[model samples]
Target: MARHLDLEEQEQLDELKHFWNQYGNLITWILIVIFGSVAAWNGWQYWQRRQAVQASFLYDEVERAAVGGDAARVEQAFKDIKDKFGRTTYAQQAGLLAGRVLAETGKADAAKSALQWVASDASDEGLQAVAKLRLAGLLVQAKDFDGALKQLTSGVPREFEPLAADRRGDIYNLQGNKDQAKLEYMKAWQGFPADSQYRPLVEVKLTALGVDVQTLKPAGEPAKS
Candidate 1:
């Protein structure tokens, strides 16, 4: 009986060795690849988190400088943010905020430069549109009518189209191009949403331009009897 048990154990050991011979290297390689991928993913996540944390702290500095109304400090803080975290959205936001503060303080050249950075380099389309629009307004104030018109000609997000048209209308009016001004004003009035808060402002503009808003109908809408 002991001899028979010894023979059966030997047979079982042989079977185990055969299985390992068939799949041992494959299993070891599969586990090595999986573990390597997990390590890489974790390392990437850590890097991203570190970047975000650093960017957030810098953004806080920018906000504080802005609130204090220190244009020079704001500009400096924005520069730091751009240098260190230009890949972050905070840098773009800093540009806009700093530009607004500069513009409010009558630093047109500085404001224009800041806004130009945001308009050209911002990753977010909405922020880019806003920056471009405000930059155009400053250009208009500086009497660079052609430059203002050029800024307005750049494409904006769909939501800003009406406002862009209205701004363009103003620029044309300033340039004494009444016909083009009227055309742009009509476009603004027509493009604006019926329920928009901005619609009334657009209405005022149209009224000033001798275009009655009440007489206008929705595009492709038939006239009432």
Candidate 2:
């Protein structure tokens, strides 16, 4: 019985060796690929976290420079953020803040450059809309009405439509087109929500154009000719 048991064990060992000889290299490669993927994923996560932390620090530098009225520092910090972490949210926000400070400091071209970068390159649609709106305002100030109109013509997020219309109205009013201005102002007035603080301001604009808000149809109703 002992001999018989030994023979059975020998046969089992031989079968195991045959299986390993057939599948060992494939199992080894599969395990290597799995472990390599896990390591790569962990490394990618670490890199993303590190990039965000660095970008945040750079953004804080921009904010500090802006608050101190140091345009040079603001530009330098913003450049660094854009160069190294342009894909990050902090970088996008830094661009907007830098643009505001640059514009306030009389660096109109620099401000426009920063705003244009955000308008063109920002991944977030809302941020892009804000950049376009602010850029349009700057162009209006420069009497570049055509440029401003071009900026406004680009698609904006839905929530910004009323403001865009109002801006267009301002441009038309400046150009002595009272008819078109009034129409655009009416569109803005109608587009504003009932509880919006901006609605009253639009109402004021309409009143200036000799249109009575009370006489106009309520929001969501078609306007009378």
Candidate 3:
């Protein structure tokens, strides 16, 4: 009976060895891949957090320079932020702030350059829209009317549509196209909600065009006869 039990144990051992030989390499590789992926994900999250913290510090530097009215310092800090963290939200905010400071300091060309970079390269759609709108205003001030029109022609986010229409109306008025200007002003007036402060501004535009804001209905709404 003892000899028989020994033979049974040897048979079980041999089967276990055969199973390991068949699948050992594949099982080891699967575990390695799963653990490696988990480690890589954790590392990526840590890196992104570190980058955001660093970028935020750089943005604060740009803001301080801007508030101090030190254009040179603002420019240098903004340059560093853009070079190191251009993909971060802090970089985009810095671009907008820098553009404003540069424009206030009579650096129109530099302001346009900064705004153009944000308009062209910002990852956020709303930020891009704001950049484009500001760039269009700058172009208008420079009397680059055609260029201003080109800037306004690009798609803006929905909340900005009314503002864009109003700007287009201003451009048309400048170009002596009163009829088109009134049409755009009408669109702008209709686009805003009744209680919006901006709606009253649009009303002023329409009033200047001999169109009574009280007489026009919102777009797509049926007019009462």
Candidate 4:
């Protein structure tokens, strides 16, 4: 009985050896790939966190400069954030802040430049829409009507569409296209909700354009006869 047990153990050991010989290299390679992928993912997450931390610091500089009304300082800090962390949310917010400060300080060109960058490169659609609106306003002030229209029409997020239409109406009015202006203003007036403060704003514009505010309805409502 002892000799038989010894033989069975020997056979079992040999079978285990044979299985390892058949699959060892494949299992080793699979484990190496899994470990390598995990390492790469961890490295990527660390890098992104580091970038956010650095960007937040730089954005604080921009905010301080903007609060101080220092257009030049705001411009410089915004440039730094955009250059180093352009893909970060901090960069987008910095651009908007820098542009507003620059505009308030009468640096129209520089303000336009900052806003244009946000409109063109921002990842957030809302940010891009705001940038475009501000940029369009500056362009209108500069009498670049066509350029203003281009920015307003290029693309506006759904929530901003009413504002964009209002801006288009303003542009059309400025260009002496009263009919088109009224049309755009009506679109704006219809876009807003009944109780929205912004809806009243558009209604005022529509009133100026000779539209009866009471006759206007919410976007999907039928016209009263």
Candidate 5:
């Protein structure tokens, strides 16, 4: 019985040796790859966290400068945010605020630049559309009709169509194209919903153009002409 037990133990030991000899290198490589991947993932996560923290600090600075109405300081802080955290939503928001403040402070050119950046490169489509709309309005104010038209050409969200059309009408009116202005005003009227608060404004525009929307309404719902 002692000899049999010895033989069994020897057999088990030999099988383990064979298994190790067959797969030892493969097992070691698999472990190394798994640990390396884990280490890389951890490193990437740490880097992302650090970047977000840094971006947040810079965004706060932008907000402070904006609130104080310090255009120069706001510009500097916005530049830092754009340079360091351009991909962050905070940067986009800061850019909008800076653009608005700059325009209010008689820096239309600088405001256009900031709004153009947000319009062209912002990750959020809605924000991009807002920037484009505001930029287009500024261009219209500056009498850059061609540039304003170009800005309005891009496809925007459904909610902005009326505003775009209305702005286009205003531009056409400025150019003394009353016919084209009426056409755009009609389009704005059609694009607006019945319950929209802005619908009345569009109606007023159409009225000024001598087109009564009430006469254009279909049945007996609301005068969305």
Candidate 6:
């Protein structure tokens, strides 16, 4: 029985060696790839965390400068944050903050630059739309109606569609295109939620354009209580 057991163990050992001889390189490469992927993922996660921490510090500086109403300081800090962490959420916030403060301080060109960067490059679609809307507002204030209209063209995301339509309506109205203005305002009014406070504002614009919003409600759907 001892001899039989020894023979059995030797067979198992021989089978293992044969399997290894056939596929050893493949197994080794597979393990290397799996471990390499895990290491790469871990490294990427660590890098993202580190970047977020550093970006947050700079964003705090931006907030402080904004609170103090020091536009120049806000712009400089925003530049630093954006340069170092352009892919971070904190950079998007800094851009918006710096844009507003700079615009308020009468630095229109710098404000546009910041807002334009956010509009063009933000990973968050909502932030991108917000930047475009704000940039369009700045262009409008500068009497660059064509530029404002161009900025607001499409890509505003589904939720921001109403605001974009309203902006376009305003521009059309300014340009004395009453028909187009009415069309855009109607779109804005229809897109607004019943619970939205801003709906009334859009309604006012629609009314000025001689639209009867009551007629525009979906058939058989009751207005909000």
Who is ahead in lDDT, 2 or 3? 2
Candidate 4 minimal-lDDT segment of 10 residues: 216-225
Candidate 1 lands at a TM-score of: 0.82
RMSD of 2: 2.8
User: Would you list the clashing residue pairs of candidate 5?
Assistant: none
C-alpha RMSD values across all candidates: 3.1, 2.8, 2.2, 1.4, 3.8, 2.5
C-alpha positional error of residue 195 in candidate 2 after TM-score superposition, expressed in Å: 1.2
Weakest lDDT window of 10 consecutive positions for candidate 1:
216-225
- Tens digits of lDDT, candidate 5, 12-109: 99999999999999999999999999999999999878878888888898788878988888889989989988988888988898899899888898
My TM-score estimates for the predictions, one after another, are: 0.82, 0.85, 0.90, 0.94, 0.80, 0.94
Model 5: weakest 10-residue lDDT segment is: 216-225
Q: Which candidate is the best by lDDT?
A: 4
lDDT of 2 by residue, 1-225 (tens): 999999999999999999999999999999999999999999999999999999999999999999999999999999999999999999999999999999999999999999999998999989998998899999999999999988887978888888888899999999889999998888788888888898899888889989888867646786565
lDDT of 3: 0.90
Q: Local distance difference test, per candidate?
A: 0.86, 0.92, 0.90, 0.93, 0.86, 0.92
Worst 10 residues of 3 by lDDT: 216-225
Give the backbone clash total of model 1. Answer: 0
What shift in Å separates residue 50 of candidate 5 from its native position after superposition? 2.8
lDDT of 3 by residue, 1-225 (tens): 999999999999999899989998999999999999999999999999999999999999999999899998988998999999999999999999999999999989988988999999999988988998899999999999999888887878888888888999999999999899998888887888888788888788778878866678988986545
Q: Summarize candidate 1's per-residue lDDT along 1-225 as a digit string, tens digits.
A: 999999999999999999999999999999999999999999999987888788888889989988998888888888898888887788888889889998998889999998999888898999899998999999999999888878777878888888899999998888888889888887887788789787788788778878777788655665343
lDDT of 1: 0.86
Candidate 5 stretches greater than 4 Å from native: 1-39, 215-225
Enumerate clash totals for all models, in the order shown: 0, 0, 0, 0, 0, 0
